[model samples]
Target: MTTAPTPSRADALIREHRENMTISSWASDAVDELGRLQAAERTLQRLGYQDRGGQEWAPPIGQAPDFDLIDSLRSRIAELEASKNARIHKLEMQALDLASENSILKRQEQAELEVRKPLPLPLPLSDDDRLRLRSDVARAIWDVMREHEDRCGHALEDVEPKHQVWDCADAAIRAMKDKP
Candidate 1:
């Protein structure tokens, strides 16, 4: 029996796998960004800046600034800034990985295309020849069906078989013939 050449199938599988990996990578990045944003907000809160109108100012100018409060706020801000930098680093790493993966996929596809050149078609068969071929296939299928029935000790009576399979096969053959 004829089969789809191995390299074409392999390339298709590889492309699908790469696509899934890319989606997963992008989801991971989104989660990482969300976590980073949350952490930044928490850090800001820890720094003692109440959410008053749009501005953040230390206690009124004349009300003696508390040294302890100032120090705590400064520390929190520093921690938040460090966390932000780390998040940025993670994003950069993800970008690099995506770029490398894209390059590899492109190269693999190009190689596959080069390896599988197309072939010329065979001459068309006469209607009689086609009918004979179909009959042969049907007989072979009947043999397999009989074997299956014997092996399972079950009649095919309960099966809800339909002509859909034949229709699909006809469509596929037509499609193949139409290909250049």
Candidate 2:
């Protein structure tokens, strides 16, 4: 005997609404399709698809593009810059102290001093270099969303729940940021 057919996205949503339940969470296909829709909206938004026609649409916690990667890289870059600035500040303070002594030898020493930070073996790549290496990987995530949009529809006006889409996407991003 043949098993019952899997529920379609439309059918699952309709049934859930009619039955006052949430089959979208339980049904695998429905969940996957919803994810795809959300991803498409996110991708389009990232690509800067604004609705001049006053249309609204967006994605939930869909595909993770370069956002996480770029954010992490930026955070690391900021930390490094702060640390480097602190080191520079120390050097400046030392220089100021030496200048106050009015000693020729101290002046000469300060001029000759070199702040050489330790370079690890195979020295770690500069932030720009590291970002360059990882950026392509992050950008590739958009293709997955694009594929979904092709199957569904790219424009937000074409999709349902247009107004709620952006809110969902914001919530998803907030949730991601909240996580360690």
Candidate 3:
């Protein structure tokens, strides 16, 4: 006898399972698309694009050269150059002033030297004159030493005796005359 074909539940179950899987996959894709759209909206808001009425914001990436940094650097360099030039000008003015003062001092020194010419030495002198000159020399030396001590706070020992002796004697003679 011919057997009737077995009724199979497997085909119906597989069709239902496939339909549910398809529906679940479509739902997942929709959620992912919604999430991407929300993320894009947030990014646009942060970039102030939303303030422009939800318009798409497309900034040029690596399409144009940025000169903002270059401009800042140029500004800084200009400021430094200006400052350096100003300082150089000030130093130059000071140097000129110093030069003028130095010349003035030199002229004054020369004039004073000319005015205070030393006494001419004689061919021969008496013993009394020699002794008087020696005493004068000693007094001059002591005066120079005193002046140096007052001006620089230096002791007589700090100066060479030979070098200071004449200066001291001259100073002493001048002091004596001033004591009118």
Candidate 4:
């Protein structure tokens, strides 16, 4: 046996807003993380660059320790720059993908919203107009059925002539039903 899950207030909001915010949230987080990484990389690159054109540490060796340290720092800075560029490129690609996905979600959300425009309020049907419409509907149904029986060699599905008025009312209802 399993316990039933509890209902939450999020259901109504989800129905209206859907999950579009989730995608934007992920994109925002990615951009923020990339920004922080790039800032750190910039700081490290500056510090390493500051050591350039400096002669320090008096030594009597073939290759001075200061020069070796400078070379190492240069290589480290290069590696850091390369990594930063690669990550920036990755973030750019992610942004493009996210933009495309967000666009598609926006279209889908719009389609999901049943924005019903109030139909031009059905004009009031006066008694004379109603009678005329009823007669017209009855005549139209009778003529169509007679033509089907004569030309198509088949009787109308339920035209027994006993429920003529009822059939006309049904046909009128069907014809005047709401359209999408």
Candidate 5:
């Protein structure tokens, strides 16, 4: 008087039961994970972690106040950098000044060398002309010596011969140049 279900129907029912058990197992795992996550969130909140403006959870500040030290160190580093830059600028200026001084010294040395350089004579004189010039210079010197002796009432030969020759030669050359 009882009816037996077909084998296909039994297989389908078994499959449906297995599916339900899998879903239940998954739901249990999800619940456990949810509880663990909630506990972790509570612990984080107690440790100063917070959700600022309903956004993502922000990191907690540590137990110690190290931010102040970090800020001071950053400012100190900035000051040191500024000091280094100023020193570099000063060194650069000193180098420029030294370069300028070196350039001026080089120019002065060149000018000194120029002054010491010998000048070329415009025209070459023959031997006869040289002899005549010497004679004229001697005559001029004798005249100057006589004039000095007459004016000072002393012999010009009292001066050293070397000294007398230079002074007399200069005057004689000037006199010759002045002649037309």
Candidate 6:
């Protein structure tokens, strides 16, 4: 079967109006032609196409352009341009809003992934280090007791201070190893 030929710009404009639809390329071409006509009309109007007595301003005696028709066409073109601009602006705003929403979703997804990740393993301590920590704990407890005895003006009984210190040190080491 033979394919149908493309419609002319004038036919496209008429079809758009009659059916309330757009044929993209053809409609754009028609609009461009309308813009050119409006620009030319504006230039001719500014240059004074007719005299006060309705005679042609230039040497061509009988040809006075129709200013009223040109005015109507210009006004229609302006209306169409304004509508096109408003639609474009609205679409741009919607695209920006969608992009912002997408970014927010991505950040939220990253946060969820971070929450699901596993904790790191703790480092180990050697036997010598463990002994040193226990000794430190015993020294600190002894110093605190001596200071307390001096403040109270008496010597306090040392009841299993070594055992208490060793227990505290072991608890601290266990806590450190258990930490994520």
Best by TM-score: 5
* Model 6: colliding residue pairs: none
Per-residue error (Å), model 5, residue 131: 12
Please report, as a residue range, the 10-residue window in candidate 3 with the lowest summed lDDT: 45-54
- TM-score versus the correct structure, for each prediction: 0.32, 0.27, 0.34, 0.31, 0.38, 0.34
- Report the lDDT tens digits of candidate 6 across residue range 1-180: 976646786688787686655466678889999999778666766655534444444433465667798899999999999999999999999999999999999999999899645334234546776667656555555567667665344322444555565566567556645766
Write one digit per residue (lDDT tens) for candidate 1, span 119-161: 3335587888666654444444445666766635533333234
Q: How many pairs of residues in model 5 come into backbone collision?
A: 0
- Candidate 2: regions farther than 4 A off: 1-39, 47-65, 103-180
Across 1-180, the per-residue lDDT of candidate 5 in tens digits comes to 978879999999999999999999999999999999889888767667886655578887657346679799999999999999999999999999999999999999999899644333224667776556655565556666777666355444464556665566656555545555
Q: lDDT for every model?
A: 0.67, 0.59, 0.71, 0.65, 0.73, 0.67
lDDT digits (tens) for residues 14-96 of candidate 4: 65565678778889999999999778656645444332324332234253246578899999999999999999999999999
Could you tally the backbone clashes for each prediction? Answer: 0, 0, 5, 0, 0, 0
Badly placed stretches (over 4 Å) of model 1 are 1-62, 117-180
lDDT of 3 by residue, 56-114 (tens): 56554443444687789999999999999999999999999999999999999999898
Write down the lDDT that model 3 would get. 0.71
In angstroms, the error of model 3 at 6 is 82
- Look at candidate 1 and tell me the lDDT of residue 14: 93
Choose 2 or 5, whichever is better by TM-score.
Answer: 5
List ranges where model 3 is wrong by over 4 Å.
1-63, 97-119, 126-132, 145-180
Off by over 4 Å in 6: 1-58, 61-63, 123-180
Model 2: lDDT equals: 0.59
Location of the lowest summed lDDT over 10 successive residues in candidate 5: 115-124
Question: Which candidate has the highest lDDT of all?
Answer: 5
| lDDT score of residue 109 within candidate 5 | 100
Q: Which pairs in model 2 have colliding backbones?
A: none
